[model samples]
Target: MDGGQAMIALGIGLTSAVDGAAIAALVRRALAHAGLEASVLAVPDWRADLPAVAAAARLLGLPVAPVSRAAMQTVEAAVATRAPESLARYGVGSVAEAAALVAAGRGARLLVARLAEAGATCAVAEGEGP
Candidate 1:
């Protein structure tokens, strides 16, 4: 996704019943795993948060989905000064490291890390960290 795009994903539970804070944490972790820095938008349902969530994803640097379009555009514009090359070394990683990556704005790296952790077959670039 471009820096101006939104990245949307499915939320596993209802905010009213599942706890928005907890789900946000999970979503953050998942985005980090995917080498993307993002947060769960505070909306009534996943549908409502789609835009915000997408914006968060773009801020962290990832491909935005339809639902995340609106929010992604906002964040992308906000973080325009940032660089995509920040996530040079990407692969599976722990939540702790992923959190650090997100904080550092290495969303793309976190996305790759999450995908690797999720069991997606990946080929690490030469001379890259594990």
Candidate 2:
């Protein structure tokens, strides 16, 4: 699946989450482990963090999506990894997983659960394409 399309959710905040070193590194680590490529990044709060989010997308050579709190919330039940902090703060289990699902659009499903290190996380999801 090296060339196949996939949606990747990235933890994106300056201090809150990031397109930071740890999280960005995990994007490759997680996708490589799962045999996927990064075609899109589902940044959960890209609207409020546009520049960083855009920079991350440009750096990764992929598109970035804005995943709203409500959109992520819609996929809470679909996440495999549960972060207590995320649950309390965002009403979702895993921000990465939820963002991935939301970015993947309707009929999306998680292809990989949340992967974390250094307070950052990543997840992958795919949709039933047209």
Clashes of each: 15, 2
**Mind giving the per-residue lDDT tens digits that candidate 2 earns over 1-130?**
2365544444332335444445567777877887877667777774446554566566677766777899889888888887798899889888888888887766778888877776566788877431
Candidate 2: which stretches are off by over 4 Å?
A: 1-14, 17-19, 46-52
Q: What is the TM-score of each candidate against the true structure?
A: 0.26, 0.79
For model 1 the TM-score comes to: 0.26
Query: Positional deviation of 93 in candidate 2, in angstroms?
Result: 0.5
| Candidate 2: pairs in clash | 13-17, 13-18
**Full-model lDDT for every candidate:** 0.30, 0.69
Error of 1 at 38 (Å): 3.5
